[model samples]
Target: MIEIRNLTKSYGRKNALDGLTLSLGHGVTGLLGPNGAGKTTLLRCLATTLAYDSGRVEAFGLDPSQASQRTALRRRLGYLPQDPGSYPHFTAFDLVDYVAILKELTGREHRHREVRRVLAEVDLTDQARTKVRKLSGGMRQRLALAQALLGDPELLILDEPTVGLDPEQRMRFRALVSRLGESRTVILSTHQTEDVAALCERVVAMDRGRVVFDGTPGGLAATAAGQVWLSDKPPARSQLFWRTADGRYRTLGDRPPGAEPAEPGVEDGYLLLEVAA
Candidate 1:
């Protein structure tokens, strides 16, 4: 449903997105990257919040750079930014209702009905009347999510949606996102490997402002297949080595003579990509 070609964006002397090209179809696609991997930059560009320096970006078969087309695309798109601003004095219900209006839900009865429905979807119906300042961080995140789901947009762009969520909250979010992807396209940009593994059918890994890997979760994991090994101690010559919870050292790179081959995971492949780049 989305197509990007040679996308380039810069900030001062640095290039945030360089020669990035990607195409997404129906279903959930996970965007995995490090802090400066241009994940947020790409999301903003797609949301039409930031303009790219060059390249073509098409959403639902229309170019977003054009004013009229951008407005039309926004009508069918839902965006949950990294930090969705809030008014502490506004209650959860009030905040979502305001956003509904911005989305052009004009009729009083219809807007109210949609606000309540989305609040319930995010499991915030009981806290509908609670002030934003009184809610927990996780609650606030869900409140933001409720606003994004207001119009039931065709394309959902979520950036770090699980940041403040607890384990249970994150699990609920995964289930909700998975369900949403059944009929529409969901683009999830996150640092959480497990989230991608559980909720996405396809994965895109980026580094240095460009996509380095685009494939299935298993295919990404296979990038590090025979490169990862486990041993009692950290391997001195390994490119990347870390101690696991089981008190063994999992190393990526040239295996030591006594190191046993260990199954590769999403994180392993991601780290390997970082090192390779």
Candidate 2:
């Protein structure tokens, strides 16, 4: 479990996280926000990889601001940054093994077994002997994920974990994350609204570095309930309108004449919140 209170982080004059407060427990929670909304800043603060200007962050009853507690928290934490850089020359097995060592998995035999287990978990067992430079973008992403899965971390912080993954790989990731959420805390930050709808029990939407909406996926969808409409033509004044596969324009805003009310989805609610913010 983790708790953040009045957290604020700044870069020069702009605040990345502005008086943000949140609490996270078991299961998967989807973090949704636009550019500059502070999702990465918040995750970095929680992962103990970045310091904040002000506020309190307590994870597993440990204060990350303190050196000793930060070290202790790192032992139980798994972090997949937005851009998890890769070593071009290291083999998949070697890369994961190297991370396992950093996590203090000292014994060679045990660490190697862990490395293999995580590699298989990410469905990269066949490519274990291949060099990172030879792997595709998706495989490299999976390799990053494999390293995060090492040590069976208690808290997993994943920022765009499905970035380069194809549909099938994304589905596999969903399954794995869904299974992981059964017992541990996983904070998944992503732009994919469908992923949130499919894998998250809780959805938190952010805007201008503050939480604009925090509730269940259904609850988020419900926020746009009566505002979504399907019409043959775009609404006159609607700012959020898009063509759906059904050959109708799905519009969000005031009702348009003869437009049928369509069921609102997570993406609809998220966009509505963005417009409101």
Candidate 3:
């Protein structure tokens, strides 16, 4: 388990994370929020990639501030930074191999075996020898994922892992992560709400660098229970729609008091949560 107590990050007078605390148990937890909502900041602090001004962080039963403990924790965790870049002219295979050594996952032959395994897992075997600069944006992301899988980590922290993939590739990646979470912790920070509803058993929603909600998708949808309605037409004062074959406009909004409730969607639930904040 991962425990974050009284976590905080300050950039001079500005607060990136304010008194954040959370306990991460085993399973897939969607870190849901908009950009600059401290999702990356929190992930970076957990990965020990960046330092926090104040907080106590314990990961996999080790304190991240201690050198030995930090080393141990890193071995058990796989992190993919928001921006995964490498020096120009380095081939995908070459860079992955280098990361394997840095992780110290194995020696010569074993390292080669591990590198080849992850490269194939990320579907980059065909372009393993291709230079990063020459690869497409999606391919570079796959290479980054390859490196993250090098150590077969127990905890995987993925920030927007499917951003560049095509629909097919994204589905494949999501399936792989879902499988990985069965035995380990997979904390995924993403702006994609569909990904959360599909892959996460629970979600941590943040706003302005603070956790505004944490619960299951169903629970989140429940937030809009009485505040949603389906309208035959949009507000009369607003512009009219072209209508979709059916004459009724099928618009959605908060139902008026004493009126029947409308079925709420995840998007509607999310909007309600955001507005309430």
Summed backbone clashes in each candidate are 0, 0, 0
Whole-structure CA lDDT of model 3: 0.82
Q: Write the per-residue lDDT of candidate 2 for residues 1-277, one digit (tens) a residue.
A: 7999999999999999999999999999999999999999999999999999999999999999999999999999999999998899999999999889999999999999999999999999999999999999999999999999999999999999999999999999999999999999999899999999999999999887899999999999999999999999878887789888978899998998889999999999999998889
Model 1, residue 132: distance off in Å is: 0.3
Leading candidate by TM-score: 2
Tens digit per residue, CA lDDT, model 1, 1-277? 8999999999998999999999998899999988999999999999999999999999988899999999999999999999999999999999999999999999999999999999998899999999999999999999999998989989999999999999998999999999999989899899999998898999999997999999999999999989999999778776588888999999998887689999999988998998888
Report the error of model 3 at residue 15, Å: 1.3
lDDT against true structure, model 2: 0.95
Q: Which ten residues in a row have the lowest lDDT in candidate 1?
A: 233-242
The TM-scores of all predictions, comma-separated, are: 0.98, 0.99, 0.90
Q: Is candidate 2 or 3 superior in lDDT? A: 2
1 or 2, which is superior by TM-score?
2
Model 3: residues with Cα > 4 Å off, grouped in runs: 236-253, 256-262
Error of 1 at 171 (Å): 1.0
